[model samples]
Target: MMTSQTTTNGRLSKRVQEIKPSGIRRFFDLASKMENIISLGVGEPDFVTPWNVREASISSLERGFTAYSANAGIIELRREIAAYMDRRFSVQYDPEQEILVTVGASEAIDIGMRAILDEGDEVIIVEPSFVSYAPLVQMAGGVPVAVGTKIEDDFKVSAEQIEAAITPKTKVIMLSFPNNPTGTTMNAAEMHGIAALAERYDLLVFSDEIYAELSYDADHVSFASLAGMKERTILISGFSKAFAMTGWRLGFVLAPPDLLAAMLKIHQYSLMCAPTMAQYGALEALQSGMDDVERMKQSYKQRRNFVVKSFAEIGLECHIPGGAFYAFPSIASTGLSSEQFAEKLLLEERVAVVPGHVFGEGGEGHIRCSYATSMENLEQAVKRINRLLERL
Candidate 1:
């Protein structure tokens, strides 16, 4: 096998070379090989795809519907997504002109950034967030300007911060909520403020709401649903988080017709379309899997409570996450840096959590622990973590 160093291409793209491996991947890789390791590292849901959704994919295969879909994705799926968005969130998007299904939410982010950014443009990223946003921006020749959300503020980014970060070269505000890593979400007021700021600055917004259906106590607000913001916001979401369909790799992007056209050009040249079977599965999910979605959300909510309470008892300052499956807890009192704490926990206690600093600079004193594992695993991990803290 040719090595990366000895490959015929000789040199990798500067963008590819500059990108670091995801921090979340590192702990999971190490933990996976260890006996009795309790991993709260990966962000994927533990639930299997709902039987109905799986049957839809199986049905598609039986019908031989296994070819390249339209570059913009199946029209019926897009229409279903549009209807779901409208019914669930009151967001209006024309299925034909506004939606493009992609390989995953990850691809939607990549295509959205590539379609709008020119060299040297700046994208405002609210951090500590999902690991991909900044690197993706760099790859597209755009600069990522990270705005740190404070723990004191429940990890919500304010309009004042957004206004402060805007420069003449600012092209987009990349927003994620309920966010990964932090598991924090913005309320209607906060989202409206961001929408207002985007309008005031004449900036495009890329809102990642993959966790929209996973909010525990509160409702998830879509930036694109705000008045006037829909025209400027590219909304990214998927079946992975809410429907436990991470392996399905089906997601969609919604934007104005002009923006969708530009993104379709890139999607066509690059990915062609999302997986056909996954698209069919997602179609079934949106149309008939509401009960399944609710079941998964309720399970996550129970897990969230268990983890949060356990962390609190362990003297870790866990900001009760309003959404998503991860818990962000302050580990500063451990007298260990986030990386040090994560490494030590994995090595000694056989519990895996991601270092907060891996998400961004402001994430230094905290760590992200996912509650996506079995309740049995979570209980044991908590016991081990408590013992580790006592020893420290």
Candidate 2:
């Protein structure tokens, strides 16, 4: 079934050719060549990894810890992660059998999809989601069916929307709370509705809660914590956002023993194990980094308030994001597409933001601005954005 049309010079695979590059990276690449650019494009945190966490890694290396861990991960790290889950989100896992350490949440997503999706299987993904979800599904031979959520609904996909998209081929539902690009969060009551549907349909759920600790209003409710839902949910989270450890490239997955075993098989052959020192660093973070996380979260909350208010003053309507550090303000009034707005802003004002359409449906006419940078940068960026609107 390999068609000549799907090949590039009879070389590249069809799937590889069809997948587009990340829109966020494209803008960052364009901005990188220019000087004095204030970029809000990448979702990385501005904070450094806390001194205690960094020191732990350094100490481990000093003591000769530069070796591959067990295929699952170092036992101590897995046990700590299990305890963190119980205390933080009320979900419990058996570290020895039900947890996996991955290169990043990105890798976890990839391996998780590959492990579960047979060719032609369907996964219902919530739209305006992280860029990786659909493409990863395609690469794994699963059809990604996207369900669009509205800003009017605070960008939270409802049970009804997901149910409507499901068919006999549907096998999984993917969710990201404290959603990327939108910075929205759903409460316990709202999550229960989706959980109910999953139970009814007997579908698996992938809940990406990487930004859970960044929530502003209510505590985050893990999808697995709902009654009878733990067995059916794959909970993915990491230290990237909350602990400011993006460079460490470590993330973990919690699932039922059966599902975990399948993903572990993929992980074992491909990655072997995460870096040894990074696992030690993560253990320190879990044991001592809560105060640091709290401080960073509070700073983000202040930045979020300022960004939303500044957008309002400039006449750009935005939802008050409940969590995470992104503010998606509608740019439709400026008479430009989201891509046009982002390009012009970068060219004319030296400020970079991601176009909303890149995040998929229900995302046009808006742009995503990250408040993860310093307050000074945020203020300057706001001024430049205002100038662009005025000129338009």
Where model 1 places Cα greater than 4 Å from the true spot, the runs are: 1-10
> lDDT tens digits, residues 1-392, model 2?
76676464478777877898988888999999999999998799999999999999999999998888999899999999999999999999999999999998998999999999999999998989899999999999999998998777878888889899989999999999989989999988988889988999999999999999999999998999999999999999998999999999999999999999999999999999998999999999999999999999999999999999999999999999999889999998998999999999999999999999999877888999999999999999999999989999
The CA lDDT at 265 in model 2 is 96
Q: Give candidate 2 misplaced runs (Cα > 4 Å).
A: 1-8
Pick the TM-score winner.
2
For model 1, how does the per-residue alpha-carbon lDDT over 1-392 read when each residue is reduced to its tens digit? 88877683467777777789888788888888899788888889998999999999999999999999898999999999999999998998898899999998999999889999999999999999889999999999999999998888989889999889999999999898998888898888877888888888899999999999999988888888788988989999998999999988888999999999999999999988888989999999999999989988999999999999999998999888999899999989989999999999999999999999999997889999989999999999999999889999
Candidate 2, residue 268: lDDT = 90
**TM match of model 1 to true structure:** 0.97
